[model samples]
Target chain A: MLIHELLPLVGDAQSVVEVSQSGDALRELLRAPAASAYRAYVPDGEKMDAGTVVVAFLGPKPEAHIDAETVAPALRELPVGGRALLLLGWPVPELPYHRLLDELVTAGLQVLQVVPLDKVSRHGAHCAVLAARVDRLAPLRTHLSDAPLDLAGEAPDLRALLRLTGEYVFGDLLSRPLRRNLAAAGDRIKEQDERIRALEKEIAARDATIAKAESRLARARNDLADLRASTTFRIGNTVVQGARRPTRGIVSVPVGLVRIWRKRGTPGERPGPQS
Target chain B: MTLLTDAEASKYWNERHQQETDLRSGGDISFDEATNYMFYLRRLTMLMDRVGLQNNPVAPLYLLDAGCGKGYFSRELAKFGHQVDGIDGSEAAIAHCRELGGGPRYHRTTLSGWRTPWLYDVVFTVDVLFHILDDAEWERSTRNLASLVRLGGKLIVGDWGEDGDHVYGNYQVVRGRDRYLPLLDACGMRFDGWEPYRFRRSPIGLYTFTRIG
Candidate 1:
């Protein structure tokens, strides 16, 4: 499908800029949706408005030039909250999404969502609409999420340490600014660790209090049960219940007899004096 | 297009197709991304599991995606070293499938009219046969799909896995267990009970069948 046909389907965007090496797909993508300011061009480090929705239609080899070359640069320039829609056209059937996802992440973009648009787009390429928002860390850190060097344990080898330093830390780009950011990240991690410890201590204290409360509740329940079972308590409960059947009958008998005598004497007329 | 005689269904789907949104995730359905993702992932995993259980003699199983609207399942299966042929009635859907030029060969034809030179080891239809509209057409379509399955091959169908069939939105008919079990039996296929699709809000299920004859 042409870009214009596909863009509107993507929903209303403030502005859209598509970067593609190929002319035909770009032309189709640019076909008349005059409503939004949608523009298509070959990737050159042209200054795009920060929040402009940048769609990278990487035709065939998405993992190669398009991802590293085109998308990475554009993503760096994207403003915070700006979205990059990466369309990997039916390149290789076996292309795992993780690779493209990692590439997007390395460029400082956080993947918000992924939608399969293979059926809707005219090119019928295995298309994935990877919506990623530019993040704070996008400008500084420069490698994909998956690292070759294992950062788990101590790396004694000098070569391995160098590789780790190069990949993880600023080795080539060990500029003052990157170093500052790394130090800041380290400080933040330390702060988080302290906070986590405090939280754990607080949770432990809360658990102890809960346990104490539960014990008290259990004791109270047992005491109530014992009180209920006591002879005095049982007698008091019965007395509190007042008149049951037999007792009620004893009170009612005399009153019942009096009423009967009164009713028998009266009969049809009100009884005069002794009559 | 004419074979899709149910005007309401045709119109509904045609508009859906024109909407240019992902059917698996974004559509008229109120399913959020997470639910839809889980549903798709679970369905795909189940399909793979079902195929694995077969232990087919063919190294790369010859599969048919009956009523492959946008060729999602077809392409996914193709990734797993399967030769797939995707067929759909809609011209636009078929056009998109062809344009996307994955390994799966796509054809624009209804299930009833579809014919192949050779039988497939696995012929499955996902969320398609239930929308056949006419009862006779549904029967004919089932028979046609069954006819394409080789002996000892499997046919996995998607629809309502309930006891009795039900209609939804005046177009989709959830062909329950009663309707399909007998239909498969008539086609000389063994009824391998229905399995509920995981993470699906609606009772969408996978109806499994194996051609014994």
Candidate 2:
């Protein structure tokens, strides 16, 4: 399954240079078209033909550091425009592919495809990475894009490439103005929140005033209710009404006045035991 | 059918609030005070995630609390670093909001008549719109709230997501998606999604829209 993915990148290359940990599986796959020259991985400082396809099947194992350094010797043999197919063993998800991709980017390789080989993926072989060295950069598809799986390499769909490019650019364009608007909107909201806080304080002050006025009115109402319920005030008011009517004033007014004088001060205040 | 007028609806809420507890006046009647608050907070948290405010946003957002009965959502949103303006028609509700201070600004205005000089990043009404039994007033309030959303902003309304309208007692008129989608489409509001309250047997949920143009 690893060879199924690697053979397309190695299609009819002038020569094949493989630094393989997966044994002769890839060599067998390349034997069909029979590349003009085939050999083991090149030694350090040994350069290969510019168009040679380098296949590094560095399988995974516990504690193995599969990084750019692991693939640097093979990359040194690759000239500009030369492509590389790396079958990396991903031990755990903690070791993300982005870390390896970062290494490859530093090593002057552009990762064109990263395909996870579920069917024939060996114990440590997590995925297949097809990459090429380029002289200049093109508008990148997202850092992690799995949509371009057209590995046939027979007729590259220029239209689909343009469409993906357009979509990414358009989305970026939309977000630019939106981010600007959101920033401006955020400033306005901050101002408005400050205003809201100020208004809340104003409302709170007004509420305090209203509450104070309400408590005063409640106290006044209680005092009025108590006065209306008092016997002396009720009787005095009756006597006054009777005096205003006509003949009842003589006894009503004098008796009410004498009773009030005897009672003195507050009607409910009992005279201290004649002390 | 003879439904309660908007003024009568306001009066009914005022009278109800005079006797009902605060949570009962504003939230699900079936829930106790603590449950209601927790339920409301959970929903609000999820809503914050949807509107990109769960992380204490980069900038404060302008928010409108349409028909903010008792201003529960408005105050909670303010706590999330957003500026909120709460508008309601009930004299008692606005008085309560004003009494519970230090958050959103309170306005004693009907949902159909609440107009602000600037647009908002979010305009939301939670379980408050169905209480508008008058069809005309309900339409007016929906349109007015939609008009207040700026481009790329959201308008979230709490109601049903079914095809037909339903009525509950003499107070609530739950309008379905049939009545909402067309009007919002005409207003250039794109329907985002709808999710249910999912608390219990209740069918009401939130309908979200965004103004794209």
Which candidate's lDDT is highest? 2
What residue pairs are clashing in model 2? A89-A124
Docking category for candidate 1?
A: incorrect
Encode model 1's per-residue lDDT on B1-213: one tens digit a residue.
243456666666656665554554222256755555566677788888777622212235688999887777888888876788999877777777788877899988889999765677788988787787898888999999998876557899998887887777666677888888888887767788788875536678798997665
Q: Model 2, B145: alpha-carbon shift in Å?
A: 0.1
Q: Residue B125 error for model 1, in Å? A: 0.7
Residue-level lDDT of model 2, residues B1-213, one tens digit each, is: 567776777788888766677777788777888888877876687567555522122224678988887878888788877788999888888898899985799999888898765677788988888998878878898999998876557899999999888998778889999898988887767799889888777799899997654
* CAPRI-style quality class for the chain A–B interface of candidate 2: incorrect
The count of residue-pair clashes in candidate 1 stands at 12
DockQ, Cα level, model 2? 0.02
Best by DockQ: 2
Q: Please provide, for model 1 over A1-275, each residue's C-alpha lDDT reduced to its tens digit, 9 standing for 90 to 100.
A: 22333454334456767665554565354452556566664355555654466776664554422653556666666665566766665443345566666667766666543333323335544444535454332211111111111112232344333433543443345456766888899999999999999999999999999999999987777666666655455445444443355576565655544544555533233223222
Candidate 1 Cα outliers beyond 4 Å, as residue runs: A1-275, B1-7, B24-28, B32-34, B53-59
- How would you encode candidate 2's per-residue C-alpha lDDT over A73-181 as one tens digit per residue? 6775576667777776654333357656766687677676555554343344556677766655422322123333222333223543553465457657777987799
True contacts kept of 1: 0.00
The true-versus-predicted C-alpha distance at residue A180 of model 2, in Å, is: 23
